[model samples]
Target: MMFDAWLTFAVIAGAVYLFVTEKLPIEVVALLVLASLLALRLVSTEEALSGFSSPATITVAAMFVLSAGLQRGGSLYRLGELLAQIRRGWLLALAMMLLTALVSGFINNTAAVAVFLPLVIAATVANRQPPSKYLIALSYAGQFGGVCTLIGTSTNLLVDSLARQSGEAGFTLFEFAPMGVIFVAVGVAYMMVARRFLLPDLGIPEQSDTGHAGRYVVELLVGEKSPAIGRRGSELLPDDAGDVVMLEIFRAKQPVSSPRGEQVQAGDRLLMRGEWRDIEQARKKLRLDYDHVARDLDGDVAAERLHAEAMVAPGSHLIGHTLAEVRFGHTYRVRVQGLHRHRLAIRQPLDRVPLAVGDVLLLDAPEKSLAAMRSDPGLLVLGERVQERTKLGRALLAIGVMTGVVTVAALGWLPIVAAAIFGCIALVMLNVLKTEDAYRAIDWRVIMLLAGVLPMGIALQNSGAAAWIAGIAVDLVGGYGPVVALLTIYLLTTILTEVMSNNASAALVVPIAIATAETLGLDSKPFLVAVAFAASTSFLTPIGYQTNTMVYTAGGYRFTDFVKVGLPLNAIFLVMAGLLIPRYFPFS
Candidate 1:
């Protein structure tokens, strides 16, 4: 039975690695584990599915909806605006990071990151700095700040719930505050000092003549008389387009990649990436007439659409509505040539999909629509026009609702799950987020990943895999006593986080941490803290945390970028956590 437990543990570890490395979607990996456990008779079907019903899962799902509301209400954008106004150079950046970290200590870190990313990007751009410099800092700050409060991240909640299940006193929302505050301060200081030395001086110009380069809706257009007309697009633009990158091309209203070598037609639109001058020069040199008829191409001519990009505004009656519902072409007199959300291409049909906050809507509409959009109170026309209005009332309302939920949960007036759900409902009722758009805001991928990986955590404990691992842990650190054992657990959990989802890492390590505490006959709080802190501090690899991935492409950073900065930060936190955790919850 013990050997079987060891074997099961090995399987779980392998599955976790495969999932973290994205070899398979996390849900598929989780399902695979469920199937294997049942096949081995380690758990019944009911047991395998138990994780789906856990309060942690429900709370996380509800939180996603609540986050969606905050985003839709423009609360995040407002916050970004404030952060952008800070005038002090690196000091201001440090202050923003500290505030971000402090806020993340109470909310979901990923949600926190999502809320702040756009703002951070805007702030960096405003300061004439490379976004790559500050974006990673914000991500790291959020992860570190989450370690400060149990409610800050799903990983902390998982550890707390698992500890309760193991007959230990679960942590309170603020229980980790003391050590967390210290760690946050230290981490922020380190970032402030390192910003000058470690970060590359991209010397980003103060004003990008590209003028809000993000909103350009530039596409490719192949001419009938061109040398490359009938040839496959792939042949015309090899996988690599050399200097000029083709974003997309339209043939008969259908998008075809240059990689596919699809033959180009007379009126095919080609979406290309180049500076304004370069694009203009290319147009002249190629002798290709511009498709001024394309709404996206010709829209906002007054502002000179340097790069073809578009923007979406809140409260435009477009919120909570899909492109299909808007009859985009007929009603808005615009056709969505392409969509970019979070810097990724959206290949799906625009009509069937609902828009989320931060989504960049690419429209082939008359240039006048840009001015009209700018006039709408709920809309913001990026690049061409900057319209600022006081949405303070709406922003405050969102903050109040979110605060109420946290207060209610803390006072035990309602369960955390109920509180979060109610908060989401209130936001929708207040029109902060439309009821129809609520579901679209929730990231189903993350929810599914959490639900699927949870059962594996349960299987580890039920099958005695946790105990088997704990026993090995005990012997390995036996000479050093409980303190050493605790350190080992923290180190192991930290390593796991670098290779897997933080939530998944927490779930996997909590059981073993508790089991080890039991074996040592010491208080479990220290071990639990170790697991929670370790799980949230996955800075070593971009794959370890979603925020890291969010900045990866945007920053043009390689994997080593994370390693170069994050590895040292990882070690710093590990030492700080190891020393502080035991002091708060001594191993007597």
Candidate 2:
């Protein structure tokens, strides 16, 4: 028993290290923990593989699909339209945080944050305030609301699932809200108070979007004697016409979206937009025989109508591919005009820069093609999603289905797992999310991580490691009181969460929390509650939460920015949890 206990301790420590280092995919590390626990004979094979079929894992996956359906329904986007009307930057910022928290409590917080990301950016641009001021607050708001409901965040469900496995009654949907609301209130108030002094205004400027006042559309034919015939389309604009945008090329009356990798040929008419002087200068620079069929040419002003923006979807196949390599123009039927990464506008050739998940591309495609762009999962077009009458109807239905799922589960008409599963089937039949989109909506990495880590909790308990650790923790803190023991659990969970995946942190700490409660002769619910709140509220670092990581580059924030902004929020959460956790979930 002692050997097994020590071995369990070693495996868990190694797993924690791997999670912190992130040298392997988090899911892979989870699988390793399961494998090690079993191979070391710490857990039976059934126990080792049980997380895959665990209720927590399945519900997490189902919630992901449910969240996708609601997101597709355009409800959040509609809400954003209302928020946009608040012109005062500070209030607008506060409102954004509030809405994010509210929406997140019902669905996946990451999805909630994602839906609001572009809206926040647009609102900031309109108000002429830096997005960085509210982006972190927006991320923190997701956590705030996430803890309010059972289904709000996967971490909540995960801890609930673990608690249920220990023979405790499953938590109701709103069980966490009493304390969660306190946390949100405190966090939001902190944001409002600290906004001016702490929130950094270092967002990346749109350097690619220079002056537009003097530019006009013009078409130039690559004449037979033109030096541009054999070169790439981008090279056609000489230094004098550097601001000119090559929108398209027509050869034999066929349109190409800027000849990405193809050589320009004579008689290929280049569709471009720039200042008339630059246009006239480009015409002279091109050496085209303008006295012939092209002499009576007059330019049209149409480029602005064709330009749009799209972001590379997270986990997109296009993340590492350059524009030329992906044949981006041909594949997506859109011309790549420029790219923004993190906060820096790439002034280099677009052909060489590799795409990343958050990369925002300035594209020139026809209106019809822009509509088609939304169909590809690899890219998310940034702006207000279409609210066409048909889409709005589907969105409404999607909203209804999601509400039913939450209602039935909350009222005990069905287990959350069952209600959620039925809700997903209804969503498909109702066509809110297409079959493929439903699959895409599930962040399988998280599902796999849950499946992979729950078993570690099982192993920890089976090997007597939990009791040993719990005894030590209680011995150190028990002299103070049960409240102090609760605080110890909360603080340790909080520390682990700041360094590793929150789900994993919750999984590892829950069994220890149960053991600690037993050692102290108290109810485990408060300890469990401490674990849930602590694991979910990671604000100390960008990597501590996925939402924070998403907005890191977009907001153009520094590493210390998270520390500077998140420290106070973390303090607020700690204080709130310490006071209210025992109050709501008494330590009897």
Candidate 3:
């Protein structure tokens, strides 16, 4: 028993360390933990594999499919367009955050951010403000909004699932809403205040010109018998050149997206855009002749090619793959000239930089193909193409399915697992989402993490480690009563969540919280809710929540930015949870 206790503690400690450092993927670490526990006989195979069949894991997986269905239906795009129309400023920031929170309450927070990201960029540009002011708020709103519903995040579901496994009633669909509403209100107010003082103004120069004046769009002609002839378009540019992006290539009088693998020919007309200084330097660096008359020749030339701006969609196939690897140019018949992510310009080796979901690409393609571009579903064409088509019928059906899931689950007509799984099947059956896409929609890493860590919790219980720790914790704070013990659970969970994944934190601490409450001869509801809330309130750092990390790079924010803005909010949550949990979930 002693050896088992020490081994369990060491495994948990190592898991925490790996989660913090993130040397490997979180799922990999989770699997490692599961494998170690099984190999060491700490947990049997049946116990270790139980999480895969757990209601929480299934529900979370189903939610991902539901979220993906919504995304594919183009509902999120419409929301973004509506938000972009709002007048830009503090009011806009507040509204964006509120709307983001509201939408995220039902759907995945990451999807909310992914859908609204480009819209926020447009809002900032229209408002003539740096994205730094609003992007972090967007991230925070998603986090805060997630706490509003049991399905708002995987953390709540995990806690509720564990509670049920411990023989307590699971959370109702709206059970989290009352306290969650307060958290969202406080978080929004704090972020609005932070925007004025704490957020940095990342240098995004205001657009003074009406028609791409600050940017240079130059047409370069490949010289006959030149050194660049017969090489791929991507090979023509220097590997380190970050200055120029290829917008369009009039090859044999045709235009395409990314010319990554296309062999460059003499007399090929390349239309590129970048900073004038960078372009000028790049022009000299790459042997090319300027096409002065090509600008005028456009009047006489066939209308086969055109230049446009496109925002990479959230679930784009292009994401995480390099242009060259994806044959981006060949596939789309488009030449990518410039790229922007999170409202900031990206520097070269454009072909090598893996594309992210929200990146905005400047592409040159055939004018006729622009209409067909909507078929890609991965790239959302901005401006004129904003009215791109979607299957409204399918989208409406998807929304109805999600609503039905909530209604059934809320009414207790079915368990959340049953409702959610049914919703997923409906999505696939009604053709709202493809079966393959449904599978892709589920984040396997999260599944693995939950499946792996659940056994550790079981081991803790079976080995009496949880009760042992609970006894120590309660004894240390029992003299102060249940309030202190509850707060300790909340605070510790919150701190751990800041450094590791929230789902992991909940899995580790929820059992301890339950044991602590039982040891005190108190109802465990308040303590359990405290763990759920604390695990979800990871505001102090970007690494705490997936949505926070989504915006960190896109917003061009430093680690301290989250601290500077989210620290106060964390404190506010701490006080609120401490006060409200006991009221709503008494410790009798």
Q: TM-score order of candidates, best first? A: 2, 3, 1
The regions of model 1 sitting more than 4 angstroms off are 205-221, 227-390, 428-432
lDDT (CA) per prediction: 0.67, 0.78, 0.78
Residue range 446-555, candidate 1, lDDT tens digits: 56666667766677888788888888888889568887888888889888888776777787888888889888888888988888888878888877776676555344
| Clash count, candidate 2 | 0
Candidate 3 residue-wise lDDT at 261: 73
**Residue-level lDDT for 483 in candidate 2:** 82
Better of 1 and 2 by TM-score: 2
Candidate topping TM-score: 2
Q: Ten-residue segment with the worst summed lDDT in candidate 2?
A: 290-299
Q: How accurate is candidate 2 locally (lDDT)?
A: 0.78
TM-score for all predictions?
0.78, 0.79, 0.78
TM-score of 2: 0.79
- Once fitted onto the true fold, the runs of candidate 2 whose alpha carbons sit more than 4 angstroms away are 203-330, 334-371, 374-378, 381-390
Clash pairs (backbone) in predicted model 2: none
